[model samples]
Target: MAHTSPAAAPGAFVAASDVAALAAGAAVFGTGGGGAVHTSQVVAEQALQEHGPVPLVTVDDLGPDDLVMLMSGIGAPTVGIEMLSSRHQIDLLVREAQIAAGRPITTLMAAEIGGSNGVGPVGWAARLGLKLLDADGMGRAFPSAAMVSMNVAELPCDFAILSDVVGNVSVIKTIDLHWLERHARALTVASGSICLGAHYPMTAETARGAVVEGTVSAAIRVGHALLSAADPVQAVAAELNGAILLTGKITDLDRRTEDGFARGSVTIAGTGADRGRLQRLELQNENLVVLEDGEVLVSVPDNVTIIDAETGQAISTEMLRYGQRVAVLAWACDPIWRTPRGLELAGPAAFGYDLDYVPFKEINR
Candidate 1:
């Protein structure tokens, strides 16, 4: 059932009616990675209908003894859209993660509140009768698992659980986030480039300061604005406190799956009043940087997302096609991402670019 522009559900709950908006908002936060949320939205809605709305709560709402587990899909967005995970596989993965953590996961949390990762766990929580945490490790999506807040906080993940659609599960024990990323990525690649993963099981008290808070509700609101407004681009920009960097048509695209990620670049030719300008967007699962005439317009850990110019709907990195008109929307990431440790993990340099991290304010100013 497709829902559009439904009145917001009161309280902290994700009903079936809210999935479309959540998906829309989550895709905006995805910055072009995190896989597309269209399919995940459908799945989530169905689960909610069958099991009732998942209770959405924040760290403050959870007890100190409540165990929260980070849940997400690990893979190239290009492949994730093609290879989907089954509910049974996700159930198995979550159970294994809980067992490895030596506690039942009382709450489910999105590792990243962007794209399909943001919406996938909604179904998981509803199906499993667990609460959904309103916060996420990354306020937005990043390519590597090492870029998460838990990693930046130096939190130890005793074990990482992964499972593909075919029921194959792997349990990896390592406190090293980088090692986890390496081995987990290799496993994802081997699993046809898409798999479900769970890690960073922590109590509510430990997660309160470590995760980006209020993002789940924020995404739902932004999605509503996108659905109801006459001008989606303007509505989204205002909702996210973002700016439209460029409005143009995608003229060229070079993309491929390598090293377990969708790595590519796209060239957009400016249209409308801003004619004759050309913008280049770099990609690695997510849109990492935007450049015009060799000058950086935006870069990680900032948000750089592409949306349908006319409709204001986010276009995932895996969905890019030549001649599709788009607008580049960008916003500053969470303040924590600007810290020294955060930059070291997710800054442009972390992605192999030789440049210092610049705040979105400075660039826009």
Candidate 2:
């Protein structure tokens, strides 16, 4: 296991091999929705070559007064394949955020954990020399930015700066976090359904309180595990202390692309220890729920990941299909999300389900 020393400065060189490991880590943290890692790694590699190495910074290393901003690509990942982004688009978003906040963004953070989203921030961080926080808004990837723990913590979601590759830039100020999601999603759809934006301005105090710490390091660990382990599923399970929810061949998948979202469910016929059993997964861009024998085993906030059982690589919801053999992994959410208010904000009930939030530990036990 590779570990950075505590005495190391916030901004230190990250080698190319480590970047590959970090990308794998991002995939596990992505919880099956941070877009693809290949794209992010390419961008990060380009930035590294042009601007030299990028640094990883912990939230504690930031000054209380420093303006830290979060940046991410928001849209349908399927659409992103066709609409590639330019570096200028990212710069536009960051610059606009600085202008809106009236202070230069001294640091950067990923809005979510996923292969691409996690690695994407590295490009911006390398280009701008902004310290990349070893933390993120969502420990696992979710479809909407507002689904982050930061939003659940009542952090301000307004004042997002958005930009398209075509040079269109706008600052969105909304009355509420939901409104921010609604407005941003609409704007993103109109702007070719793939826009880069920066939001969630926070002092170091707020960051310490809400952000999932050590996520960048987690992503790196996950990536390394995936690359080094003979069985990647076991590697991920060890890294997350997660349970292998189910392993079987996908027998059916009900899917529909609607309202700019991919909504669906997958049914898998059990094998091995799970033989004679059935597993099902519900998804909305991100995997939201998992069921075994008709009982809810995992719900939102807690991660539900589907991976190719044979390869041990994650399978995105959009790529889910019948006849694919998959292994389901369930990991616990951040401790804060187990609270009443956190449940009310993002639990299964909030997603229109009748069941209450059940921590993965309890279910696994």
Best by lDDT: 1
**What's the true lDDT of residue 356 in model 1?**
72
What are the per-model numbers of colliding residue pairs? 0, 4
Query: lDDT per prediction?
Result: 0.89, 0.78
lDDT of 1 at 116: 98
289-319 per-residue lDDT for model 1 (tens digits): 8999999989999999999999999999999
Each model's RMSD to truth, in Å?
4.2, 3.2
Q: Write the per-residue lDDT of candidate 2 for residues 1-365, one digit (tens) a residue.
A: 11121222455555555678877777767676777777788888788787877667776787866877888988877677678898678777787898888888888888886758888888778888777777787777877766777876777764888888799997899988778888888888888888888998888777766777777777777777877788988888888889887888999988765555667788889888888989888877778898876799889879888887866777776677788888998888877677776777778877788887778898878
List residue ranges in candidate 1 displaced over 4 A: 1-11
Clashing pairs in 1: none
Tell me, by TM-score, which candidate is best: 1
